[model samples]
Each structure stands twice: as C-alpha cells, then as structure tokens.
Target: MSTHPLIGWAVVHPWPAAGIAAATLAVLGAALWVTVRTARAIAWPPGPVLVAGTGALVCTGFGADTSWRFARDGLGMTDTTERAVLFAAGEIALFACAVMARANKTATSTDDAAGTTGVPGILVWAITGALVVPCYATSGIVGGTIRAFFGPVCAALLWHLAMGLEIRVARPEALSTGLPAVVGRELRERLLSRFGLANRDRTAEQITRDRAVDRAVHLAAVLELHPDGALSGYRRRRLAAAVARSGAGTNGEQRHRLLQQLAARRTSGQLATVPLASPWAGTPVPDEAYPRTPLGVTGAQLRTMDPLAAVRLVRAAHPEDSPAEVAALCTGYGVPVSETQVRIALRAGNQVAAAPAAPRPVLASEPEPVLGAGLRLDVESTALVHPEVQSRVPVLAAAGTRTRQVHARVPADDQTEPQHTAVPDAAHPVPAVPEYAVPHNEDIPESDRDVPDPDPLIEQARTEYGTAVPSYRALKTRYGIGQARAQRIRDALGGTT
Candidate 1:
C-alpha cells in the first residue's frame, strides 16, 4: 500500500517538513492573535471577522501547497530544502502584504476620501493575475494552478475587509454625516497647531481670560451695530458683561477706544488720500488744542448742521482748537464727527463768521421739532425717528398707546360715511401732530384703521422671550393673527426668528 504524496514527501525530508510545519503554525498563530486583538479594539462586526478568517485560512493552506509544488516542479528545483525555503518565503510575503495593508489603512484614516488616491481594485486584480498566470502555465497542474490564482486574491480581499472594519470604528463621524473626517485626527492636528504652545505655558485661569477677551472683541462689534433697543435686554446685558470682563472702562469708554483702534487699523490707508496742504496732513498738533470740553454749538444744532460747516464755525470761533478738539466736540454733541471731516473743511479754506447764527423763530402753525435725549423727532413725519431711539422716547411711546386706544374704540363692522376734506385757514391751522401718526383719532381716515401696528406686539414679544423670540408662524399661532401681521411683528423685532 502506497502512502499519500504529501506524507511520503514529509517522511523523506523530516527536518524540512518539521521546519515548514513550525513556520506555518507560527504564522497562523500570529495572524489569529492580530485578528482577535484588532477586532476587539475596533469593535469589528462578527460577520466580517468570520468571513475574513475563513478566507485567510483557506488561502494560506492552498497557497503553501501550491508554492511548494511550483518551487519543486515548475522552477525545476530538485532540492527539498530549496523548495521548503521558497514555500516559507511565499507565506511571509503574503503576511507582509496584509500587514502593509493594515498600516496603510490606519495611516489614511483621517485623510478625506475625496482627497485620497487609492490603488484601484481592478488594478490590484490585474497585477495579481499577471503574476499568477505565468506560474500556473509553467506548472501545468490544473487544480494547483487554480488554487495559486485564487490564494493571493482571497488574501487581498481579507486585507480590504480588515481595513474597512478599522475605518468603521475609528472614523464613524466621516460616514455619519456623509462628509469628510473632522473629529479625531484632523481636529487634533489643527488644535495642536493653534493652541498647543499657549496651552502648555498658560494656566487654566489665564486661558479662560484669553477666551473671554476674544468673546468681548466679537461682542464689541455687535454693540457698535445694534446698540440699545435693537438688542434684547438679555443680549445687551450679556454683551455688556463680556465687554466689562475685557476691562472696557465704565460707561464703555474702553469699548469706544477699542472701536477707534479697530477703525484706525481698517482705514490706515485713508491718511494717504489727504492733501499735503491740509493742516492735519502736517505734524501732529499740541494736546492743549484738542480740549474735551463741549463745542460752542448745542447738540441739536451740531447734529442738524453739515460736518464741514460745523467744523468751519467752530474753527473760526476758536482758532486755537485743533481738528481733534472739533471732532471731540461733535462727538460729545451726539453727532459722530471724524478728524478727516474737520481736516477737509480746513483745507477747503471756507470763510466763516466769528459766531454761530441765532435760532429762527417758529410759527404757531408749524410744529416744533422735539429733541429727545440723543435723538431728533420731527412731529410732521414720525419716520425720521430711529427705531432704536423710538423705543426709548416717551413721545413715541404715547403714539403707540394712542394707536391701541383708537383701535379699541373703532368697531370692526361699522361703515361710517366718508367725511369731506377741509383746507386749514388762519383760525384752523394744521395740527402739530403728524399727518399719519396712529395713536391720535382726530383726522385719521376709516380706510387706514385696519393697518396693524407691529410695535406693541414686538415690544410684548421682546418682554416675553428676550433674545430667543419665536418664529413668525409660532407668533401667528400664539397671538391669533394672520401671517402678514405676524411677519410685520417679526420685521419690527429686527427680523429675528
């Protein structure tokens, strides 16, 4: 009775067979350990792990057998030692390929999929086929050749599965949002580049202070654009607190200084545009010339007058005053005046009187403009009042109250006859009230009654919700109003949802 070919060969070459068996056992043990360890670490799914393991075992067994036969017969190597050596080398090479694939997968885990350049699966298959076909053709063993062809292909697929499992565990954020990886490796690198040194040197308190300062800088910009009523009370307080934490002085002086610094940095090139002949274009003036005191003109008059005219008038009366002083005076008067404006006026060489002109007398029929604290309100046209200022002044507050009263008195179903228009004479002059001002009921037409006032609702919402006001639809549902009315309320409240 003849033994199997494999058993007969092993008996003939005991040492080589033993060495081959030992190497095979060692490689399989190492592979098993690595697979188990990696699976546990990345929480790999059971199905993929089982499939990969099965494929790896099948491929390794087939590959070792084919490598041994190919070395002995196809390569014409009669020596058993050489054949065993070739077989072991082939197994090592396959293991090395799998290890390389694992490393490559780990390395590129954080790289954006869109940015990465990977070896195409077709190209890998093609290369594997190119190498296997020639060896299979030379060996002339159909079953052995088929095993050789599929062995490396299955091993490649196993490597791919391992890599996929690693990515699934390590970079789930990339897949979850259908976006490139952002959370772990890339974010760590960016944060290290930006804050590593500072974090190392600074204490927790110091780091916190730096963050507060950064927040204050951002809030300062918001306050500049939307001060007072434009911001909800909560937002205003939060912004003010942030500014104060950054050491902005009392009454926002430091905040204003920061604004000036920012403005200067933004417009640093503006000085180049000034003519050489201008007084401000030359050397800096003495500090004494730029007094902080009020200018000769009142705040109302300063705001009403042109910037250049105001500058010229101030300059003529106080020739000693510098452009900075004039600007300070205008600013104090609630009229923001830049030094550039004063310089431009001085450069123009316009003639001016030694004193400002006297106020013109107002006719009884003509309404006197009401000057509020830091605001000018024209009775003839309520539109001129700034929305922020309108929120503060009592006169406009009264208008809102009167509007509500008028709405309440007029019955929704009543259809009164249209009254004839009357021209005002000496006895019945035009009333001091604005033509379209809502709260008063005297001359308002019936047609205009339905036009809703959004101010009251806006104020009510602000009082209720602070900065987190509801959407227009929510407001419509809450207030039992139409979409248009709700939209008007939203618009009045600075268009915030």
Candidate 2:
C-alpha cells in the first residue's frame, strides 16, 4: 500500500528541516542580541541592513512556500545538486545575517564602535519597503491593513534618519561672560552676511546663535572653530578659498605662510569681502557695501562645522524647524550636515550649562557709580557747579559733630563772583560772625573788589606770576593793594586769612 504523501516528507528531509531550524534559531539569537545592544541609541552599523532584510521577509513571509514551489516546479529543474547548493546558500545567508547582527551588538560596547550610517542605509530600507507589494501579497486583507498603517510610519522614520545623517555641529566652548564680550562685531557680521540686511535690530550675542547663519560663513572667517569645522550647507563661500588662493601646501611652512596672509587680510577686511563676493551678488542687498547679496555668513564656512554643532545652530535659530527641515536648509546653504548628533550635543551642552552663571544681566545697571563711605543725601542744591568741577569735588565724611568745609557753590546772581559760605557742622552751634561778614562787592570795580574776581586773578597768576596759587604779598605789593583786600584774595585762592 502507498504511504500518504505528507507522512514521510519530514522523515525523508530531516537534515534540511533541521538545518533550516538551526538557521532560524541563529537569526533569532542574533536579533535579540542586537536589540539589547542598540538600546543606547548609538549608531548601529548593521541596523539598516537588518531593517531592510526583515521588512522584505515580512512582505514575503506569507507566500514564501509558494515562491519556493514556483521556482522548483514552474521552472522544472529538480536536480539534487542544485537543491543542495540552494539550501547551502540560504543557510550561509542566514549565518551571515547573524554575524552582522552580532557585529552591531559587539561594536556598541567597545571603543572600536565603528558603527555608522549615511545615504546608503537609507536607500536599502527604502528599496526593501518598495519591494513589499510586488514580492508578495500580505495575508490578504491583513497585509493591506498593516501596510496602510506601516507605510507612512516607515517612510517618516526613514526621512527622520536621513535628516539625522545630514546635520553637522560647530560647538563653541562656553566662554566666561565675566570677560566683557564685544562679540556682534566681525564674527557676527561674518555670520550674517547672507541675511542681506542690516542686522542692527538684533544684539551681538543673539546673532552669534542664529541658525540661519550657522553655515553661511567659512571655518576661517570667524577665527573661532578649526579651519575644517565649517557647517555643510550655508549659502556662502568657504573660508578655505583664501587658503587655496594663497596656494598653501599641507606642509607646515606653507600653512604658516598662508595663515599669515589670512591674518593680514582679516585685519584689512579683505577676506570678509572676498568670500562674500560670489554668493551675495544676486541675492539681496542690505546696503551698497554688500550690493544685491544678503549680508550673510558664507555656506562654505558652515560646511566645515561638526555635524553636531550645526544642529544646535538650527535649534537655536528656529526652535520650531524640524530636523528634516534643518538638514535640508543646511544642504541648501551649501553646508550639508546631519541632525543625528544634535540631541547628543544638546544634552552635553545642557550638562555644561548648569555650571555657568547666566551672563546676560549686565544691562541691569549703568556704568556710573554709587555713594560710598560717606553720608548720603539726595538733596538738589542750588549750585552753579560745572560738571567738570562737580566731579573733582570730594564729598566729606558726615560725622555729625565734626566741622567740614565744602564749596557751598551759590549760583551767581548779578554778582560777578561765586560766593563762598562757611558751612558749620550739622551738630555744631553757630558762632556769631558780625565782624566776619564782609559787605557784598557786586558793583565794586576790579581794583576795589573785596575778593578780586577769581578768573582775572587766576589768569594773571597763570600768565604774569606763572602760578595757579599766588601769595597774598604778591597781590598786595604787585598791584599796591591794602592788607584786607590782599587777605581776602588770599582766602579765595585757598589760603588762610
């Protein structure tokens, strides 16, 4: 009697079945290892490959038997050698997949974590996704449902990843705000040369952080980052062009000479204009100085920036711009960068941020001074004190019982001289001064005046006597003045009577 057709198949092909099962177990073990290892979110080298292969398997999983049968029956080739070769190849492929998964797992923990991705990984996942419908129908309506949900989601993930690969960063160290930063100068001007407008509206610090300018300049123009750290997509010329123009070799001597030339050009504003000349010519003109080009940093400068720093620039510039948008903008600006390192850079920067006290509160107080070590009163005295003289005069210590002499600067009326009055201490009793009080000399002639006008005396003392302070005897003998007038003149000249 003939045995049932299905009864002996497993018995007849036990080795093949066992081989398939073993390959499946190997793949599953590798996959589990990769899943656990990649939890750190570091770039896994084989991640995209696994994603592509698995997606293809999912698409073909339901019809895998039928495809195999079609290859066997429709083609009509059932040679034992071919079958063994095909099985061997499949087993080897599964083992290779397992190795790739193990590699990703091993790499993340080691210092040789050479895991990375770029445009190629994105293409593989894309192609695998594109192959879904053409290769196999997914469990009838279930596949349709899953595809409907998975299609856009997968596309979005790929887009995000592609964008991540494009972002670059140029992280400047957090400088101490205690050093009065006068930024917004050439550094800011170089950054914003592409914006094509007088950025006078924004402050220097704000301009330093704008994402729009991150890639517009070259690595050299700002003298901040390494010459190779330009962002990838800014729409301006690279600062390296200056080096190329100078014909510097990688040799130390040539590089040194090139650096000197660049320094000279920078001092003269020649490098600032040279990089700006090509891109800005037709863009927008902030002034005749930058004619037609939006005054902005050159794109070549941004290209040299580290991918992580560019992401920071975009986030700082437009907190709302999506990673994809930032990456695209970087590319458009000629700085081609990835947004992947953005999160890492931002997290690291935030850690550093907690250490530095905020440096932006310098504007709360003006540069003038405050009252110190003396009695403080805000009374507005009726004094015609010159601002220059007001600054020079010292405010005396106000010990209530102590007598202190301050120039009681009484404003001039019709009188020619500024009257000086003796200010007794606030706590001291006033002494009678009937004899001390001199008659007013408002209408007195210069020769007859009691305190001889200070200006004329000062002028005469400076010119003829060649002294700023003169003696009472000099005036009494020189002009034949009496003793009382001479004494009065002496007192006005800061002398005792």
Q: Would you estimate the TM-scores of all the predictions? A: 0.25, 0.17
Best by TM-score: 1
How would you encode candidate 2's per-residue C-alpha lDDT over 1-497 as one tens digit per residue? Answer: 87866457757988886887799999999999998888757764355544654553443343333334434554454875675445223223332333443344333322322233333334434444443442234334665445533543343344333322222111123221211133645566677566644567866544443322232223455554433445433312454443444334444655565456446645775545655456646867554321111325445555566766655665566678766566666666655665555446456322223566667865675443334433233334544643211223243767223333222322345236656866744443333333213223442335665453443554554466543556655776686654445544455444432
What overall lDDT goes with each candidate model?
0.59, 0.46
Give the range of the ten consecutive residues with the poorest summed lDDT in model 1. 401-410
Model 2 is weakest, by summed lDDT over 10 consecutive residues, at 169-178
Query: In terms of lDDT, which candidate is strongest?
Result: 1
Which segments of model 1 are wrong by more than 4 Å? Answer: 1-47, 111-127, 138-145, 169-497
TM-score of 2: 0.17
Query: Per-residue error at 308 for model 2, in Å?
Result: 39
